[model samples]
Target: MTGRSDNRPTIVITGASSGIGQATAEAFARLGARLVLAARGAEALEQVAAHCRTLGGDAIAVPTDVTDAQAVRRLADRALAFGRTIDVWVSNVGIGAVGRFQDTPIESHEQVIRANLIGHLNDAHAVMPVFLRQRFGTFINMISLGGFAATPFATSYSASKYGLRGFAEALRAEVADQPDIHVCDVYPAFIDTPGIRHGANYTGRKLSAPPPVYDARKVAAAIVDLARAPRDTTVVGSVAQFVRLGHFVAPGLSGRVMARFIRSSLDRAERVPISDGNLFAPPRDAGGIDGGLRSPKQRALVGLAAVAGLALAAVLLRSKPAYGRTGHAERGPALPPPTPRLEHSR
Candidate 1:
């Protein structure tokens, strides 16, 4: 149990079972911080906590579903009980489905929105009161480059990321009076995490991140930096910064090129069996700090040509509107409602 005498910074990290969350835990653990780690999978969460303990941190696993507001509130309460003061709360979970808007199921889209956008909202909601009580705490929201740029095949993911940026900005405004209670957003480029492996794939072609993929530990170091010296916004990769600048300079031209590039990549890639991934349930093959996508065997799949084409072309892509012969905007036919799937109950 962490008491006032413990003198270690108390941090709460969601999505702690793998990827950036796991890396962040290890980074803080090396500093001997007391951590409260949360994720949906009980077994995986415990494993992460055990690892953190071995790394010199006092950690406990709290299995939580961020989509549930009450569950998130309980997690906040648990963190408070553990340390009596929540020094930082990092909302780090985001899920996605890769596919055309029409092809993906409605439930899957809703799940993405829930996990990526609303789930973060729940985390903020639960932790805000705690932070207010502490009068000085850092609240970190993990927003990817997707938050700035639109994703072509991942329509729901784009919507959720865009929404998350807006939500974080509005929350920052609301907390302006508290100088010490900071609201921070982190934007990183394509990271080599189990995120790709865990994401639902509606596109038949196998999904792989474009090059310049970063290490998860890099993002973890960024998170630790934020905890020490909180900032309004931090963009981790140079490629991400370039994309943002390009989008600002010529939004229309850059968007079209990015869309075309993704379309070409999907068309040329090899096909694979589609999966719902770990969107509705815990991953069968849970992950660690890295996804191993940068391995030599996997490197062959994403050739240099694709990365060069993507880089030379540009960035940012919001889907184009359907147009009638007369040139008026038109709405596409509505998708049929998704059927009740047994996986939802799990």
Candidate 2:
């Protein structure tokens, strides 16, 4: 089915209670896409669903933990009940642990891997069968630039992102013969999302995404486009391209830069305590899409930067004629080699 038709496609989103997921839900809702929203917080999911309905979109909230394969299957079943078929599944659930590796608990690291990596796997497993049966579907994987660069204090975050990139690559290959079935990977740079506030903090300093934070709506808009016209990969921030290039050109120096920032810049920021923020439990309240950290002036500046970044990517893609087996742009001659991984918009 063509995704351009208004109010036709049924979409499902994990981590839909807040941040990028919440923003994405609203975006698709505005397009008249039927939505199935899932997250650990039922109250928060219902609230988002209500907002979608107010926007004149049909939406159903199903509280789900992506870490649980069974729960994800049930989520798929419930979503199917809504519209009889699922057109898109956005695996957007992610959690972070920020601290020196030794200082962080093993449990915290494991949880990050579970939520960010294995959780996404579960999403694919539950949804791919349906896609294969229907012979057409879009699977959106929400990854970040950390998938390429090694984060110093947030080692677990880096590992999960890197793993996610690999996971998407493998899944793409497995579905190579199915032209209509699409697996889309999205890499967004630092975004002003409630995820930063909800992530676990152990650095003895409040954890925050470094500057040049893009709006969550930017990434959400990309996801909506993927639903309408499937593309293998999309990069949101310009910095993500730079990081991929830097890390490839000088791995040692790139890592050193990250380490220095974590040690000096982040360590010097506001002091905080060791606590697992919403890793194991639902947050007390469902935070909204915007993180509310940046002022209006900062947002305007970032918006311009985001536009410039998109323009640069467009020019580069046009110049470079490289296309991978999946018919998506691949890194090669004509420009600096591009990597498959990138940073988070969230």
Candidate 3:
């Protein structure tokens, strides 16, 4: 259990320029939490900071690249400079790539690993000492469904999320005895972010329909809820829950099912020139709401994915009769055997 203080808590969110991070900052600000927002785009960061201010909270924009340890350290320092102590540090920065592993360049994979995995490490390392000294802090890691279950054409992304999940779980144990520190992991499915087009690359004959995506505001709301009631883990979305169930009931079969879907998506992806240069360009147009709100096209795609997901869920649930049966009966071997008598720390 972590101790709570009455001070206006300070929050530091990475990748705050757009998407989930941006929405999260706005949500926190509305709740009167002081915020320090970080992202690579100075212009975007400033815009988000302005919105946060309009919400009646103090905010500052720090142009940061999470992949850079020095930059992340600077972010922490900036946040500390804002308030006497930090309340929460959220490592929400990440990117994605979609294509065959062989089709994607090695450098691209490395960049993703560095940004997604190493970046989190740097942010945590920078803040852990502060938390330990203050003897009270929370680390909220924004992970993904891919962190727990491997998906097709997302090898590098899967590896990074897996590493991050392990890191968060291990850190939680290490800080168990510390009553003032907390580690929370959040996993969400595809979010309707510019990342779908900007961060992910497709190489095939035709563009594939976007995956089931959620509004950034919804994800941000979940983050705020996590902050108020810190949990060791929280999975975001019905689709994510169903997918997790599938993986648990039939690990082998689930892997095959995911592979088949991915293979088809990859085959249908439009073939395009792979850019050797960094494709982290700013959005061509920006002004209104972020990617979380469903556009007409996105709504149609979501409806389709929802139907398909429901069908898949029904098939998996039927195939495995042992699910939710015999209260204590073991489910399929989706996860490793749980160790009994494990200690729970703060």
| Global Cα RMSD, each model | 12.7, 7.0, 9.0
| Regions of model 3 farther than 4 Å from truth | 1-6, 200-211, 269-272, 276-289, 292-346
* lDDT tens digits, residue span 1-346, model 1: 2222366778999999999999889877766788999999999999999998987789999999999999999999999899888888999998889988899999999999999999999999999998788787888899888877777889899899899899988998898888788888889878889988888999998788876677777788877767777777887765676566567667788778888988888899899888999899989766987887676644453345346534544433233331111111112111112213211211
Local distance difference test, each candidate: 0.80, 0.81, 0.73
Tens digits of per-residue lDDT, candidate 3, 95-175, equal 877677898878888888988899999999999999899887888899988876886676888899999999998998999
- Kindly indicate the candidate among 1 and 2 with the higher TM-score: 2
How many steric clashes does model 1 contain? 0
Each model's TM-score?
A: 0.84, 0.87, 0.81
CA lDDT of 338 in candidate 1?
22
Which residue pairs show collisions in model 2?
Answer: 144-342, 144-343, 144-344, 145-342, 145-343, 145-344, 188-344, 188-345
Winner by lDDT: 2
Clashes of each: 0, 8, 7
lDDT of 2 by residue, 76-99 (tens): 999888878888899999899888
